[model samples]
Target: MVTGLTLLHTSPAHVPVFDALRDREHPGAVLRHLVYPELLERARAHGPESVAEDLRGLLGDAGGPVLVTCSTLGAVAEALAPALGAPVLRVDRPMAAEAVRTGPRIAVLATVESTLAPTAELLAEEADGRPVSVRTRLVEGAWELFVAGGTARHLAAVAEAVDAVTDADVIVLAQASMAGAAPLARTRVPVLSSPGPGLAAALRLCGADTTAAPPA
Candidate 1:
């Protein structure tokens, strides 16, 4: 099935990563990418309503399932989902669920401050009153590197930020863009990527066979 790849970052680097991952988990699936690099900055400076308006506009024209990949916009996507005609899913939902399961102590890592609250809220909602603790860490100066097209440096900074998690059962990578940082981090705790599980959830919601999807 065709899927709309909604993003708030302008870089082409995330495209190949998502493509490889989508193909690996669901071969031959069609994808249409839509990116607006300044969307998050707007959300941070302005508010989600402004971003949601654009998201709603995109959803109106999207032909198939829509997967919003920006962690900062996850809450906005979910808020807009019920009103849309097609399936609208946030990339971090599944990962947040998995994090709660591993939690009591979960550390969420993000390069942007706009991402932390929404991510933490999602984890809390998924926690289901069984006692889950969330700690948010911002990888200092990382977002600037991304804006400057220094992806390798941006990812390296995120990996280095993992060192700040003093005690945690698992670490949650708040953005799909941070997935690459997992292996680069020098941490013993399990690091989970949002997009992998998110795509899996989207495929399942669409009634597609996800037999090719790898284990978490």
Candidate 2:
């Protein structure tokens, strides 16, 4: 079994994305969820590193390499990288890079306020001094729908939020949980999700080819 670790601020939003990527390498892989208390808003205020340490403590002795997933925990992930000695699956970096590459006017949508700085920094770095304009917005109360089992409704609200940031060439869902709403966010704009690049990187780091499905 190919086991991994995921830190979820809400319900199983990251699970489907991970499962989709896992199926390409380890079909029916057993996923271990390290559920931390809902830290969406708190993550920004308290810092993600502390939360990551809390998660690391929760994952005691669960062997095999692990991948930590978080949309708002980039700083925490960077801090935890050395300790975990495993690839930390931060959703913002790649998504930001992709958004910058696609367009100058980028819209970043997130539930947490802390995600903006790191995301903006990453986009600026990827733009290579090019005059790329970035616009960011926050969507409050959307993650609640996912926790209430209203995945579709939550996604639609996210799409509506993305639509609110009009005249942008690309839209980036800063939260991994927000990734499930990508299909609905297709409004004449390219919507990028963390799972696509994050999972691809995870597979490569695990020495697996992402092209073929994992063994059943």
Query: Please, what is the TM-score per model?
Result: 0.90, 0.78
Rate residue 131 of model 1 by lDDT.
91
Pick the TM-score winner. 1
Question: lDDT per model, in order?
Answer: 0.79, 0.67
- Local error of candidate 1 at 23, Å? 2.3
- Show where candidate 1 strays beyond 4 Å: 1-11, 213-216
Instruction: Write candidate 2's Cα lDDT for 3-63 as tens digits.
Output: 4444333345566667776666555444565545465546757765546666565433444
lDDT of 2: 0.67
lDDT score of residue 127 within candidate 1: 84
How far out, in Å, is residue 111 in model 1?
Answer: 0.5
- Error in Å for residue 176 of model 1: 1.1
**For all candidates, what are the clash counts?**
0, 2
